[model samples]
Structures are given as C-alpha cells and as structure tokens.
Target: MPPEFVLPNYVLRVFTLFEQFSDRLALVRGERKSTYGELIADVLRIAAGLRDAGIRPGGKVLIMAANCFDAPALQLALHLHGCRALWSAPITSRREIDQFASLADADAFVYDQTTELGRELAQSLAPMTVRTMAELFTDGSPYEISATPVPDSVLQTSGTTGDPKLVHHTQAFYEQILELAGAFVANGFPLLRHYSSSPLWLASGQITSFFNLFTGGVLFLTDTWSPEEFYRVVSTERITSTYVTPPMLYELLDHPSGEDVDCSSLFMLNVGAGPATPARLRQGIARFGPVLRIVYGLSEAVVVTAQPGLTEDSAHPERLASAGTAYGDVRLEIRDDDGKVLEPGQTGEVWVQSNLTFAGYLGKPELTAETLVDGWLRTRDLGYLDADGYLFLVDRVHDMIVTTRRNWAIFCRPIEDVLASHPAVRTAAVIGVPDPVVGEAVHAFVVTRSPVPEADLQQLVTNTLNEMWTPAAIDFVPELPLTRIAKVDKVALRNLYRELHPDQTGHDDAASRAGEAR
Candidate 1:
C-alpha cells in the first residue's frame, strides 16, 4: 500500500488565512460580494462533494468556466481534494474545446452552468461523470481537511501554436506564489483590491487571482473587458492593481473618457503578455503617473522580469524599450544558438530559471525536453541584457524575418516600434510575407489616429532604420486582430494579407528591388 500524501504547508496556510480573515471581503463579481468565511466554506463543501462523487485523490477533473465569484473557491476545492485540476476557458472555438477535452483524459468534467460552451461540452464529453457548478455545490457534507495526495494542475497555454500545449504545474508553483505574496505584504505594498478579467485557465490570470487571495486582499472577477467598464470599476471600487495586454492598454488610452476617469486610486497597472510600444508607454506614463509596471514572462515562467513604477529615465531614454531586470530570485541569461551564454549586450535567446517555472508540458515529453533543458526554461524569445541588467526583447525566434538582402535577419518589433513612434500612428504590427525577390518582405499594418500617407510612413522607417528594413507595403486598418488573450494575432494578420492578395506572388516588386538596391 502507498503511504498517505499530506497537503503542503502552503495550502494549509491559505486555509488558515481564510479563517483569520473570515469576515473580510475576498471576492467581488458583479453586484455580489463574498467574504472569506463564505469562500472557505464553499471550498470545503466542494471538496466534500468531490469525495461523495467517488473521485479518488489522484483523479483528474476537467473544468471549464468563465471568471466568476465561484471560480476561486472551486479551484481551491479541487486542489484541497488532491485532484489534478485541468482548467479550460469557455471562450475558445468548439473545435478547440473538443481538442482540449480529448487531451484532458479527465475522470470527470465540471463546468459553469451559465456558459453555453460549458453546456455543450458537458453534453459532448460524456460517459464520464459531468457536473455543473450548482450540482457540485448542492447539499454540502461535513468534511474535514486531512492528508491526501499532493495536488497539481494542468493549464492550457494562450494558443501561440495551432494546438495549445498543456502546461503542468505542481504544488511548488502555488507555494512560490504564496511566498511572493508574503513578500508583497511584508514590503508594505498597497493592499491589493485586484481587478482581473483573466480567468484561471490562463497563467496570467492564475497569478493575478491567487496572489491577491493569498495576501488576504479583495479580488474582483469580471467576465467581459471594456475600457468604459474598467474605468467605472476602478473608480467605484478603488481598485489598487490590475493587469492588461498592450492592445487593451491602447484602448484604455484612446477611450474618450480616459482623461476624466478617477484613476488616482490605482497603485499598479501591470502591462504584459506582449511588448508595448515605447511611444505608447510614454503616453501611459504621462497619464497614469509612475504606476505602469511592465512585466515580461510566459506560461512556462510566470513573472520572470518586471519594471515596476515605470518612469521615463532622462539619462537613458531608451530604457522605455526594455522589459526590465530579473524578478524575484529569477536567474536570466542570454544564450546563442549553440547554448553558450552570451555577454551582456549580445543578442540571443532568453533562458530563465526560477522557483516559479512550470514543471513540464503534459503528455509531451519531446517538447518538454526541448523547452526545459538542464533546469532552465528556454523562452525562445530573442533578447539581450544591457550592462546595467535591463532586458531588451528583440523578437520571437519564429517571428524574425529572413530577408534576401544578404540573407539578413529582420525583427518585426523594431519596425513596429518605429511606426508606432509616429504621432499619428496609434498602434502598429509587422509581419513577414513571402516575396520572390526579397525572400521574405516586411509588411506593416498601422492603426492611426489621423491620416498618414504611406510614403511618409515608409520614409519614417527608412530614416529610423534603413531602406533595407522599410516595409514593402503598408495597410491602414481600424484595429489589429488580437488573440483570445489579446496579443496581436500575427497568424490572422498573415491570413488577412493572403486574402487581400490572392496571387501570393509578392508585395510591391518595385519596393523589394529598391530595398535590395539600398
């Protein structure tokens, strides 16, 4: 017989905090506010329900839901019962949901009744026990916390690939978050009234949600995201911290009521998930005071680097382009293709090692082996560290454009940055399109606040970089396509470009020849 597994001390500590702050408000969803007392009781009741349902300690339970008041308690209950929680958001396509369901191999499926996708998945993923949130919480039993199997989780990536990879994390990940939360409190950071639209299925959401709860702070969960709602909630609730992607931040800045909003209560506005243009960052700084904290991380390693209290450094104006230095016991290094560590200021892939790094990819050993090598996670992001230790990300290895101009490697971020620097350009995205002449030509999509001629934009890039890096073609767009998680969807952009140019022969042969000539 196997020995009994005990819940980690960190989990117990969280339960203890819930008890200590029983009457304190913990979660706010819509008009409903829940106290820690209610949250803890809900967790225990759900755990009892799981046990009554005959799910063993190590059983894998798949969950699909939107961000709601019940989500945090439900996830905690799953972990408390020693079940491997596999969480998926309901926003994905039906086909993608089916794929995720197939990959889950779960012993049971649980979902929120409010979501249409949840109802559809519950019907489709059958033969196994399927229960809605209401069913799971019905008729609570008297259950006590005891030693059980160690809990773990499998989270879906943000769909950077055709098939989203499942990232596996163990109790250690939560323990690290608890430690970080403790540090946050001890350091006298503002008591977070955190507002987040990111659900538990995403790594960003998990950190934001748990980091607040663990510190005995209020967490406001919202299902939808809009600039107007964000402003309303921040002002009304006095939200101290929140997170947003670059695209979302742009919307907030461009909104008509941005100048009128009472955002003085906000202490931290974490911007991450992708690069924000330096020009836009300056705008944010000018408006929000020094509250924008630029975070750089991925699902594999959540919170590797953070530039907190972002300000425009007068001596180093270029620091606006940096993602900041290593964060919280993280070891960051730049490595060449050969795996040799590069000197500071040398461009290469970014590798990170930290307690917060994920365990491995679920059911994909080959990929896990490739991504996690020798205790370090290969970020697959090209960047460099300055002599002062600031990290500057150039591009993703896959996003680089290999031009025919002496087979030069061109990164889209630099070109996008140059275009975004223009006063008229609100946001910009660059992609590499197939070109018979230049091998791969740089094509840009710009969303502008005012009319900007293509010639002027082309000349800006030419002056900022060089003629070789100038876009072969430029398209004016109302907005850029974003992924489910709000990062710029380059794949969709490529498909759009292809749709616009069915011939697929090339974009601007004259421009390509001109660039080659330069």
Candidate 2:
C-alpha cells in the first residue's frame, strides 16, 4: 500500500475551544491552576508577543522545557498563531542540546534556568532569541490568532545514533492524530485529560499532552517520573487517563502501598516505552485495573498497533504473545527479506499504511524515498499476524542477531518475559553473540534487584531455559540504557556490553538477587 494524500478537515478550532469552554479547569500545575479562559488569554498574549517579536507564520519557536502547564500552552499558542513549535525535551548534556538546537532555524527558544543544563541552554538560545512564558504574556499582538496550513514536525533520533534525520510531520496531520486519540477518550468522559511524566521532546507523550489540550481536555503537569507522586495524582487529581513507559509502570508498581493505591478514577492508561512481560502486564492489570493499554509503535510512524484494555488474557495471552491489532485507519503487513508480504503466523518485517502517518523526512529526500515507498512505511521491526488478526512482534531487523543456531530479537518477547519474571530482575535485554559451538549464543542483560546474587540469578535462568532456550552467557547490569522515548536502548546495550566484558558478559550481583524470593 502506497501513501495517500487526503487531508482531514479540522473540527476543533482554537477560537471556539477558548470561547465555549471558558472558565473551566484547563491545566493543573501544582500550586498553579489555569482555567481554559485564562489559558486562552495567555496564549493570545503569547501569540501577540511572537508577532511583536517579528515572528511570521511558519517561523520556528523551539520549546526546550520540562513538563509544566506552560509547555503545552505555548505549543497551542504557536499553532494557533501559525508558527511551528519545535518542541525539544529538556536535554541534559550540552553536546546533545547544542547539537539538536543548532539543527533548527528558529525565531526564538523557550526555556528557563530551572535546570543546570537548561540554564546553559537558555544562555545558548540568547543569541537565537529565546522567549520565556513571562515574556510572551507581555507582548502586545492581542487579537485572536488565525489558523494556517500545517507547519513542520521535526523528528530527532534518540541518540541511539549520533545523527538522525528530522521526520517531517505537518501540524495538520499531527493534530489530527491527536484528535483521533482524544475523540476515542472523549466517547465516555465529559472531558479527556492526559498526564505525562516524560518531557515533550519525546513524541508519544507530547501527543498525549496536546491530545488532552486541543480536544476539550485538561493537561496536568509532572516534570519527571516518580511512582509515589503519580500515586498522589491518581487519587488527588482524580486523573482519568495516562500514558507512561514500562519502566515507569514498574516504578509505580513498586511504590510503598503501590498495590493499594486508589486509581479507580482512571479511564485508561497507555504504556509503550518498550515491550512487556506477561507477568508485568498481569501486575499492571492487577494494579491499574483493566484500563491499561499497550502501544507498540516506533517514533517513525507515531503508532500503528495497539492493544487497549491491556489484560493478561487479551494482549498477553499465555500462548499468543501478540502486540494486538491495527489501529483505526491503519493497515499492517509483515514482509520477508525480499519485501514479500508474509502469511499469517509467518514472521517478517512489519510495514504500515495509515492516514495518521507522517509526511516524510524534513530535508532528507533519499531517506524519505527509502521509508515512504508507494504509501507503506517500512517499519524495521519484525512481527507477524495470527489467524485472528492479532499481531505478534519478533524484533528489529537491524537488531536481529543470527548465530549458527538461529536468529532472535536479542531483546524479543520470550527473553523479556523470562527475565521480567525473575524475582531479582526488574528489566532485562537479551543479545546474541558469535559462538564457536552453538553458532550463536544468547547473553542476557539485566537490571537486577538490590544486592542480587550472581550465581543464584544465573541458576534461575539455567533453571528457566534448561537447555531448551538457554543463553550462551548471563550478565548483570546496574541499569539498561533507555532511549529518550523511554524504551530500552538495545543498540546502546550491545555497545556497552562489548566494552565492559570485551570477550564475555558479567554476572549479577549475588546479594541483589535476593529480592526475587519476595
């Protein structure tokens, strides 16, 4: 299937949202709450400021801030006023921040001195003209902003590679993608509200925030991940729906009284930073109830597959091991090495076709040609569909490791499940290496429990796999490197493993392995 060019009509306009839904709670930012009316007022002022600052329509405004109420509000303001908001996550390393910031041609950058690196970024953006929320409010272009054609959506690689092309997503399609999600959430509740802990530079959570804002929903603020704090929000804020990574889900499940936390008010929860184990899904279902939704899509296409109502029985059935079915308006195909579509239950590279997909790479036409062929976006992930239309993920084609014996994801489902179930292992990734005997042997990387015992943990895997699917080696790690999107950065893991062990992997900390016994 080739890409199609049918533009979706915009239903929810910014002006009407401001007028009809005024004086309602629009954003909750700790001690500072902003009503829709107040939010609109600020946005209008900011728009006026951008215009006053000589920022014409299509001029870029880079947002490098934390998860505050002002962040989403600023983005909406820019969209309303016909400017592209290049939303960057609160980057830490100066090298990373400068590297990405240098890539964009912008009128202004928005950030404050709240963080050490952030302050430095603010200084760096001074030459490029950075504007804080306070400055935007004082600008005098106060007439209501008019909508324009879609602006550019830039996609940055998660530093898995040194340089990544900016994926070109127009504002029109990006907003529509969010609108679809918000519409799905609003079918039951009076208003759709979403909360995100990760910063906006990460695409999924950024959309979750905007989905709540533009489509008749409130946006709440949480700058970073904290299980205990999230527990408070579920009860105090009466939060309805949330999107978080699997690691954060694990953190929430481990909070003191984490199991007993009252989250009955929640309508749905989206978790997609990475793959999950059956036990992790079961634990989430038990903890968050049936409202949990597992999303399995790379940043390249936003989302193509999802298993809402993430339950032990449905998405993670004992025998199925599937990532669920296609989203609305999205079609999926699993293709083999030669790009031939595979049959049901056959594994191959997964490609997707959908109205909700992105346009192309911003400046890279060759890369765009390679990715957006005809209309299909060739996702490098390997997966298969069952007879029932349920999709099962295999692994990345690039990340796939082939030893003499077999080809495995290295961090695919089986190993993720087995290790997640390990009492001492909180998170793990499996990699394959050259083996003289078995052709290829499995090496497991684990984020073990505190004071884990190396020998006991090794024995656990030996007991679990028992020669049927045993790893060539087992290594214990303090933590796995996570992508900015929050998924396990397997690329980084492979490199780090190569460095630390050089020839072989390390064992788990013997004392830390004791927690699994709990």
Candidate 3:
C-alpha cells in the first residue's frame, strides 16, 4: 500500500486530473463522446443551473437517471458544490421514489428525460424544484463553490422489500476511494477503455465509473445490458476493463454471441455484487481467460475483498473458491454470535474495520449503532477464513434455514451450488419457505435450457450432500426476478411461495404445480 495521502475535500482531488487529462475522451454513451475539458465545463454549467434553481451547498439532491452522458456530469457537479448527491435507481417504483424523496428531504430532484420513469418523477415531484438534465446544462456559466463538512454522497440499497435503506459516504470515504485508485494505478492497474452496464445507482457501477474517469479512461455507458452488445462494444472500442455482476456475467457466458466475440483486448473483467458459483467461475475463466477478478462487497462496506489474479497452486486450490484477501486498509475477522473472534477455518459472521465502509445507515441511528461498533462494521455474512487467509463465504446469516427435523442450520449456497453443477441447469436459486412440518423448508427455483424433473434435482442434491439438505420443493421457471442490480430476488420468491400456498397446507405435489402459473 502507498503512503496515506488524504484530501480534505473529495472534489479537489478530482479536479487535479482536469488540467492533465483535459483533452482526453472521458465518457462515451452510444454515439456521443465528451472529453474531460468539455465534461468539466458542462459540470460547472450544470452546477450553476442547479444553483439558480435553488439548490444550495450542504443540501441533498436526488438524481434519477439511466446511464447517459449527463449523469456523471450531474454527480460531479453535486460533489464539487458540496451537496449530497443521492442516486436513485431508474427502475424504482413510484412509491419508492416518493418515500426516498421524502426520507432524504431532498432540496431538489434532478432527472434525465430519456426514460418514462425519470420524466414521471420530474412531473410528480413538481411541488419540489425538479430540473431535467436538458434544463440544467443550458448555460456554460462558470461557478465557484467550496466543499463543506457534509457527506459527499448517499447510496440507496436495492432491498427486495419495498423499503430501501440509505447508506451515507463522507468526504473522507471518497478521499480514501480516490487514494486506492491512485495506488492501484501506480501498481500498473490497467485503465484505458472501460465498459459499464450496471445502473448508476449501484455501488459496483458507481465506483468503477468514478475510477475510470479519474484515471482518464473512456467509459462506455449503456442503458440496457445485452451480452451481444457488451461484446460488440468491447471489440469495437477495444475495451480494456469492465465490471459485471455475477448474474450479468452468466448471461454473457451463455449468450450465443459470446462464442465468436473477440475479447482479446479485454484485460480485466471484474465479477462482483454476489458470489459466483465455482462452475460458473470456471466457465467464465474458460470464456474470458484468467482475467476474471472476484470481488466481494456490499452497500454498507464498499469492497471487502478482491482476488485479482487466480494463480492458485496445487497447495491451495481452494483459493479459487475464496473471496480473496482483504482490500487496502480493511481488517477482516470472523466472530461467533457471542462476539468471540474465531480462529482460522472457523465459520462465523464476518466483521470488517475499514475506511471504505459507509458512514452509517441514514436516519436509522439505532440500526446503525447495531451494525457499526468500535470502528468495525458487522457484515452479517457467514464465512470462514482458511489457514492461507482466503475468505470463503457460506451464506448470509439471515438466509440460513433451520430445519425442524434436527434443528439443523442449512445454508442455501451449498445446495444451490449442487443444483447449478447440473448440466441442464443454467441458473439456480435456493430460498427457504415457512412450513408446518419443518421450521423452514428449502425451496429451489431453477432456470434451465431444458426441462428436468424436480425429483432428479432433489436426488442430485441428496447425492451431493444429505437428504435433509435437499430442497423440499423445486420450481422450474423461465426466468428469476432480479433486483435493480441483477441479484436474484429471493424476497420475491418467498412472497410468491406464500401467495401460492397461503394456507400453508401440505405440499400436495408442489413440484409439479409450482410451474403451472407462476
């Protein structure tokens, strides 16, 4: 790690790159391209427009838009003016938009006119000052603003439930992020041309986009994700690096266009947001070469661990299955429920102490207190560290299903992994549903190329593990509902299960009936 060099203000650090990379192409959206000089000018103009519209420094502004040329500029303007920019997902429901708008007490709502939802939000929030991107960049007026003590930004969570929590990031956190980027660049991290398909609201996309621009790389922004389009962008633009969630990576690997796409120019393909099954990881390696970097992170703790290169030797082949070691100044520990730190190879809840962690959940002081303790953030993820210091995630602590038969705790990832290993299975999700017979029954929802009998899948898990760990019911679905960031919507599946069996009656051959409608 490089010597700690912290900036009092985050935007000041960003501005330092302006003079050097001014003429370089900074962003590319479809056919549109903008150089750093032009982008900085537009950012200032937008800031002036926002100021004229009654947005003041030290206030919060909600920005809702898809990937576009204006989105980054607006975010930069917010930071440069010392306003807390809150990024709301474009797919957010009207109710969520209203809730978040009210919860954040935003001074103004800035949106892009490209999407219907963005336009609708602009109209509905008319009572508050709502300005479209087109309206914000009307003047190239230079503006001068200084940073304040307020946080730099807020990231909204993509909770499966109707409610999403807000995580705050202070200016210190932003400084640390830029410092890490500088350190990585000094260590020969590639930054030339990058592609980002994730929505701006997601931390995964937001972080990557920031670093790419800060390092003077051209970022290819896309509103929608298609494996074919991603590959086409990579080959045509010679994209050197990109970030893909596990689900998106699966799509890229399975897409027919992937077979012939020229990916030689790609140097780094980061896999993050969720764990990638060993089978899928290997398959990705086969398709994208060994450039796959496994990243483990969450909304609260930006990035906990990342395995950049998969050079696992025979001595520690299991390192391929690990989430890699700690990142930067992050400290990792596995602790039992009683707050006892467990030794290596002991499975427990993961705790992290890091500057990368968010300040805290917005407005939920009690909840934040419960999570952040003594400068350590409770990750709530169940994992164990091996003797070689590789971290292996088992599952979310709350996601563990406890069977009534023997009061045994069953982690869903292992069962899901076994099902995914099946030849016909394309993607598999294992969720626990409430049952009268068992404390919680394991249910599997699978998307496959061809139909396979539920009994066969049950036997596969049974043979792999024991019968108790096998799914109580299996449902074949054409597709799984994804959250805004593309992770499996387990909450939706749980609700669907309840909706199907409202009475919680007997299974009544649920396997066959599960696919009937839902």
Query: Number of the top candidate by TM-score?
Result: 1
Report the lDDT of model 3 for residue 222: 85
lDDT of 3: 0.80
Off by over 4 Å in 3: 1-8, 138-141, 145-151, 311-313, 451-453, 499-518
Give the poorly placed runs of model 2, Cα more than 4 Å off: 1-12, 113-115, 125-127, 139-141, 144-149, 178-182, 314-316, 406-411, 422-424, 436-440, 447-468, 504-518
lDDT of 1 at 298: 92
Residue 61 error for model 1, in Å? 0.3
Name the weakest run of 10 consecutive residues (lDDT summed) in model 2: 509-518
Backbone collision count in every prediction? Answer: 0, 21, 0
Candidate 1 per-residue lDDT over residues 283-331, each given as its tens digit: 9998889999999999889999999999999999998999999988899
Q: Candidate 3 residues 1-518, lDDT tens each?
A: 12232224567668777657898889898889999988888888888887888887767888888888788888888877768888887787878877777778788888888878888878877788888888987664468665454446787784545776888877767677787878877888677688887666777777788878877788888887788888888888999888888889899988987979899988888888887787788788888887888899888888899898655457876677789999888899999999899999999999998888888888889989999998999998999998867899988887877677887888888888889989899889887776657756888989997878999999999998999999988888888887767888777777676676667634443522332222
Cα-based RMSD of candidate 1: 3.5
Q: State the local distance difference test value for candidate 2.
A: 0.68
Q: After superposition, how far is residue 205 of candidate 1 from its true place, in Å?
A: 0.7
Per-residue error at 6 for model 1, in Å? 3.1
TM-score of each: 0.95, 0.86, 0.91
Give the per-residue lDDT digits (tens) of candidate 2, residues 135-219: 7777454655345545555656543455555655675556566567556656765575666675566667656766676666777
